[model samples]
Target chain A: MTEEIIIAGFGGQGVLSLGKILAYSGIMQDQEVSWMPSYGPEMRGGTANVTVILSDDRINSPVLNEFDTAIILNQQSMDKFESMVKPGGLLIYDPNGISHHPERKDIKIATIEGAKEASELNNKKTFNMVIMGAFLKIHPIVLMENVHKGLEKSLPQRHHHMIPLNEKAIKVGMKKVKVIHDYKKLVAEE
Target chain B: MEEVKLMKGNEAMAEAAIRAGVDAYFGYPITPQSEVIEYLMHEEPFKRTGMVVLQAESELAAINMVYGAAACGKKAMTSSSSPGISLKLEGISYMAGAELPCLIANVMRGGPGLGTIQPGQSDYFQAVKGGGHGDYNLIVLAPSTVQEMADFVDLGFDLAFKYRNPVMILSDGAIGQMMEKVILPEQKERLSNEEIIKHYGNWATTGKPESRESNIITSLDLKPELQEIHNQHLQNKFKTAEKNEVRYEQIQCEDADYILVAYGTSARISQKVVQLGREKGLKIGLLRPITLWPFPKKIISELADHAKGFLSVEMSAGQMVEDVLLAVEGKVPVAHFGRMGGMIASPSEVLDAVEKEINKI
Candidate 1:
């Protein structure tokens, strides 16, 4: 099985790092993975994104136009990537700066109040971890044990003290995510 | 066994150079490839492996340093992007003429001049066809994965030393920036001056011993006849490389009706095209040229006999297509599909080009 994901947000929003963690988690499970980021001037205080692909078999291309899942953290990213999701795919977004909500009827849509939740948790840096928790709640591509190990590998040793807090933020995200539309249920009704 | 780690292509190459017993690294920083030198500086291979890593003031100075080190029969390397590589053309030509063995990497970006700092394969002509003046050829290796970016360092150095010719690792920004799992090689010690004398003492200018004739390394020949002979000798070396060093990968080619030919990142996209076409019951295959200089003409010529048509996909305006045409020799229709100025062609786009070629055939 292969899963292609695009995580996009503002430059400092941990968009690239989120994707890197997912890729590392995939590796923890002994899966083949690739992480490619949109680099250069565009990544300096501008919209930054990364494409991560995890597969049981050899991965052919790291660059893709369509994705199975799109984790959008900002309004600009949501607007740009909302339609790029494949039919019956999943799109998870943060409702913080979204002026226009996603209106697609062919894909599954989920929302996480990541900014509000991070503020409530009193740690704005855990915003990305919260979104990742919501994603894993909907689709458990990698096991939680693997995700914990991945965090250990990705973060510096000094940051290890915050692992429990990050874990708490993820659980908060998993509990707070709201499903706006379910494409599978819609198709079943049809 | 060495451990596996997820590494960027440029960083992997730097680590590989340190482990490959490279004597010195002289390079200037450029976008999309700065990580190579940055990793080297951070690792401080001089402290770890006794290898010298220096940041040159310019690409010209870096390549000249390579030339100087190589003249002493040492393993030296330098890397740059398109514009910086352009600045090193004169030194590269001199290295070829002087029969110096060194490694150069061009993490290509879009260009005629000062192109965008994004991934591109537009340097195909400049790399495979010799960018500098006069008669010369560089053994060009095209790597599509981060692992290859590391493996090719050792391979490049070995081939350079075998033929006493400069070799180039031709990669693009996409591969340079992407991260993937790589199994790094074990560290090897750098060759000492005494070892260099023992192995390459015949021609190396290692402080010419009193017992032998003085060794000289120069690209100049005052007599036109001697220069002609030198040029012919270089030509013969290129021919030997062409015969023995062509490398390529063929995927799903047997019983296929159409074939896609590409290298580097374009090859990655073409692989998806092949898979998508096969899903639609189209018999499509992909041929990736690992060595751009040798061109893999024999394989392409053989495949042309049975294949309905060929699509040459690249990031340039159809430079490699000329070579493909030469290989096919009008046996089947060959078309070109490309994106220029750092733009990437998607899988669907490549499939559309393949469908068009098949229809024409």
Candidate 2:
């Protein structure tokens, strides 16, 4: 199985790191993964994006045109990546800065109030982890145990003490996510 | 000890250099490749392995520093991007002329001059065709994955010392910046000054030893005939490399009607094209040149005899296609598809190009 995902947001929003964590989690599960970030000038306070591919087999290309999932964090990303999601795919977004909500019908849409939730937790750094948790809740690509392992692997040794707070934020995100549309249920209804 | 870590291609290359027992790394910071030096600085290989990592004033200085260290029989390396590499051409030429064993990495970006800081294979001709002014060839190894980025540090250094020639790791920004799981090489002790004097004492400038005559490292010759002879000697070394060091990987080429020739990042994209084309019952294969310089002429010529057509995919305005056409010798239809100036050609676009070439056959 292969899952092509694009995670996009502002530069300091932890977009690339979120994708990196997901890729690392895939590695924890003995899966093949790639993390391709948008580098150069675009990453300096501009919109940042990364294409992450996790596969049971070898991943051919790190860059992809379309994706099975898109975790959008801002309005610019939401506007740009809304149509790039494949039909019957999943689109997860933090509805904080999104001016125009996704209007697609063929795919599933889920929202997590990541900014508000992170602020509520008094740790803005955990915003991306919240969104990651929401995405994992929708599609359990990796086991929760592996996510903890991935965090330990990815975070610096000095930041190990913060993993517990990040874990709590992730669990909060799992409960806070609201599924706007379920493609499977829509198909069944039809 | 085998250790698996998720690392950027640039960082992996630096880590590998330390583990490979590299003596020194002199480099200037450049986009998409600065991480190599940054990693080296943070790791402080000087403390761990007694390896020297210096930040040079410019690419020119960095390459010249490499030349000086290499002349002393030290395993020295330098890395840069396209524009920075342009500044290093003169030093590289001097190293080639003097037959200095050193490693250089070009994490290429779009370029004619400061073109773009994004990933591009535009340096294909510049790298494989000798960017410097001389009748010489640098052993060019193209790495598609981060693992190879790490692995080629050792391999490139081995080949450089084997032939007493400079080697280049010709990578693109995509591979340099992307992250992947790499099995890092085991740490090896850096060669001490006594070891350098022992192994390379004959030709190296390791002070005048009473045991032998003083060794001089210079590219100058007062007589034109003597310079011609030196050129011939360098050419012979290149010929030896062509025969012994050519490296490539063929994917599903055994039973295929169409072949796609690509390297580095383009090869990664072409692998997807191969899979997608096979799903549609279109027998397409990928021929990836791991070593771009020894050109893999024999293998491509052999594939041309069986394949119906060839498509050269690249991130430049069709550079490597020239070599492919030369190998094929007009035996079959060969087409070129590329995206220049930092834009990457997607897998579907590569498949479309393949279909367009296949339809002609």
Candidate 3:
């Protein structure tokens, strides 16, 4: 199973970090992983992005022409990557940022106020964790336990207490996203 | 087993480097090729395989690190785009002059200045003809597919060591950024550090110079005759490489009336043009050069006998096409098709150029 996901947002949104976590989790779950970042000259205050592909099988290419799933953290990100999503794929958008919901009917669109919900936990960065949890609940490609361990390793020691908070954020997101059944249609679901 | 998986050429090159048993990676982050470093950074090949990986201060530092590691005969590589490569030319010329083997991958982007981050193949002259000011040629391997991205590492390093010169895996942004399927080779056989040191450690400035005379590695030759001799020797090695390492993919060329010369990312697009030209009953064929330095000039020269006209297609304006004319040597008129400044020459555009050329005569 190999899944390609793109996480994008404005600067300082931790979009790159979220992509790194998925890459880390893929490695932890005994899969070949490749995480690619898009930072061409624009260092800060610019759009940031990361492409993460996880496969139980060998990974062939790290460049993705079309992503199987796209998780957008802001309106600009959604607008940027919405065109590159594979048909009938999963797109998780933060409702707080995206004013216009995507018009695609073939793909499953879950526009959630996940960021607003995550900010309730006193950290807006946990919005990615919230999206990650929704990703796990709906897709469940990697084991929740493995992802938890990956988060533990990736998260700073100071935020060790936020582990529970992240977990809860995932649960909140899991409930809101549309549960996808066709495993073949998604990624890494052989 | 042959398999297909969608991948970008840059990522595939990184994966291929790992498979090629690259011992160390010292490079600065750059566009169109950053995916290679990003892959190694997160995958942390060093943690898994104990390979040395460092993001250096500058491209200058990165190439020097390669020079140092290659002196020890260890498998080391550095990747960069256009402008960054200009800085490394001095080091590359030095690596050749000093007789060190290393791998350098350049996913070429637009040139001159900070042109654009998008992909362009304007570095052909810089790569094949030698961008550095010296009389030396790096074995340049240009891959047309993602598989070649992985496959060229083994080939690039092999040629580099065989000739004792730095070799380049020349690819562009289209190949770097585009996704394609590739089958990875098993990397069980790798050169150990001790083995590397044992092979080339004698010259490596390793706590020595007191026991024996100092071993100075430099390209400077005060005597004109000595410099000419050195140039001749370098030319001889290049001739051997040219004889031994010429690689080209020929398709629909069995009875080809017209030949198309292309390489790397441009080759993939040229393939479709060959088919489209064939469909139009043009008796057209394509020759995709896999090795840019050890060019398949001999083959292209031979193809000139039966061919009416040769069309050289490239992403750059007309760098590689000059080589085609050199190879053909007016035996057949060599035309060109290209889209520079980050423009990709599509299949239809190539076919249109061929058709227009055919109508000229």
* TM per prediction: 0.98, 0.98, 0.68
lDDT of 2 by residue, A100-184 (tens): 9999999999999999999999999999999999999988999989989999999999999999998898899899999999888
lDDT per residue (tens digit) for residues B122-203 in model 2: 9988888999997889999999999999999999998988888999999999999999989999988777768876665468
Off by over 4 Å in 2: B197-201
Best by DockQ: 2
Candidate 1: chain B TM-score against the reference chain B: 0.98
Q: Rank the candidates by DockQ, best first.
A: 2, 1, 3
lDDT of 1 at A130: 94
- For all candidates, what are the clash counts? 0, 0, 7
lDDT of 3 by residue, A1-190 (tens): 7687888887787787777677666656667766656655553878888777788764533445568898887778878788777887778777675687776655766666667777887878788888887777657888877778777866779988978877888788787776333434454543
Clashing pairs in 1: none
Off by over 4 Å in 1: B197-201
Q: Rank the candidates by TM-score, best first.
A: 1, 2, 3
Instruction: Select the stronger candidate by lDDT from 1 and 3.
Output: 1
Task: For each candidate, report what fraction of the true interface contacts it reproduces.
Answer: 0.71, 0.81, 0.06
Look at candidate 2 and give me any clashing residue pairs: none
Error of 1 at B182 (Å): 1.0
Backbone clash tally for model 3?
7
Better by DockQ, candidate 2 or 1: 2
